[model samples]
Target: MLTTTRLDRDDAAVLVDGAREKSVEMGIPMSIAVTDPAGHLILFEQMDGAKVSSIQTAIDKAWTGATARKGTHVYNQLCVPGEPTFGIHNTNSGRFSIIGGGLPVEVDGEVVGGIGISSGTAIQDLEVAEAAVEHFLKVQANQH
Candidate 1:
């Protein structure tokens, strides 16, 4: 069997809005994005005063997490003391940036999507993403 599932604009928008709101609530500007299971951008937004560099980074985080079907930084957990992918910076591509702030979005415990937020400090970025994920899980939980 073969199948593919993608996040719609509305769903993506909700994530962006949720992430952005949380960023604002916490007094930090942010660049937020949602990616489909294939790691393609579904929705993206930049809050005022956010840096441009955050966009690519945010999308990369989401894609890495979603495609890997694990935390974006799974590599870090698996890497050796000096593994090339260890403490990977922006250079490595395809599922690297596992330093928190990015998470896979799942349904029935299977990752079907992901959300990424950047433009703030690492802690702030992770907080925003975490809040969004928590809300998403709650919504899904209520559905069943």
Candidate 2:
């Protein structure tokens, strides 16, 4: 059998903290979700003033990123009209999204989990998610 890395509670907390820091810096209230490599939710948070509707979207974004093993922006490019992955968003009961704000967390080039952010503009969401992933990577690097 093959082996894979997973995020523990502390790791998930680190990711959430990173995303929250970026959201605060940008003055954007956000819903943040972190998911395991198998696309199961590990942690989720909605900041004050964040939209309730974004809760599900944030979870779905993390699920998509974890399962797809790439940033959602890449999926956006693939799922556009005339692309090879067109109509992908229509699958998974519409849970799949090709939007920005989803990013996979990698350790030594292996995707261990994913982070998603919502309740702001697409760019803001993406920034927060990226910040979380970056923080995760930095912490991993320090452990070695």
Candidate 3:
């Protein structure tokens, strides 16, 4: 039987906090979103001075990554010209934010969820998500 693991509110909050802390340390205000393996929202937050427009986009990116089981930017990478799934952004009703900065959160060698950050530059967004990933890895190692 196949099974799936979902992150509790606490784990998801840690994931968001890790991302937010990194962003602030880098002098960037941002928004962070975390989702379960199935891409349902677990928790989300926006830092002071973040753009109001980026809230849902942040969530969408994380949700898309978790649900699609791939980075949202893959849409740009794999959505080649003439690809049937190209322009999925339109097909998906704007839920697919085909951009960098969304990353999957894995545990036990499997994706338990995902993290997404926005409101800063694309690279900043990546930095926050990467920080969350790093925290997850380090915490998991400590549990051994």
Best by TM-score: 2
Ranking by TM-score: 2, 3, 1
Tell me the deviation in Å of residue 35 in model 2.
0.6
Candidate 2, TM-score vs. the true structure?
0.95
Backbone-clash count (model 2)? 0
lDDT of 3 by residue, 52-140 (tens): 98899899889877877777766767666798777777656778777777888878668899888889877778778989889867876
Computed on alpha carbons, the lDDT of every model, listed in order, comes to 0.76, 0.90, 0.83
lDDT of 1: 0.76
Model 3 segments beyond 4 Å from truth?
80-85
Give the top-scoring candidate (lDDT). 2
Worst 10 residues of 2 by lDDT: 134-143
Quote the lDDT for 121 in model 3. 76
Q: Candidate 1 lDDT, tens digit per residue, 75-95?
A: 546655677655554444534
Give residue 65's error in model 2 in angstroms: 0.8
lDDT of 2 at 141: 80
Q: Give the worst 10-residue stretch by lDDT in candidate 3.
A: 72-81
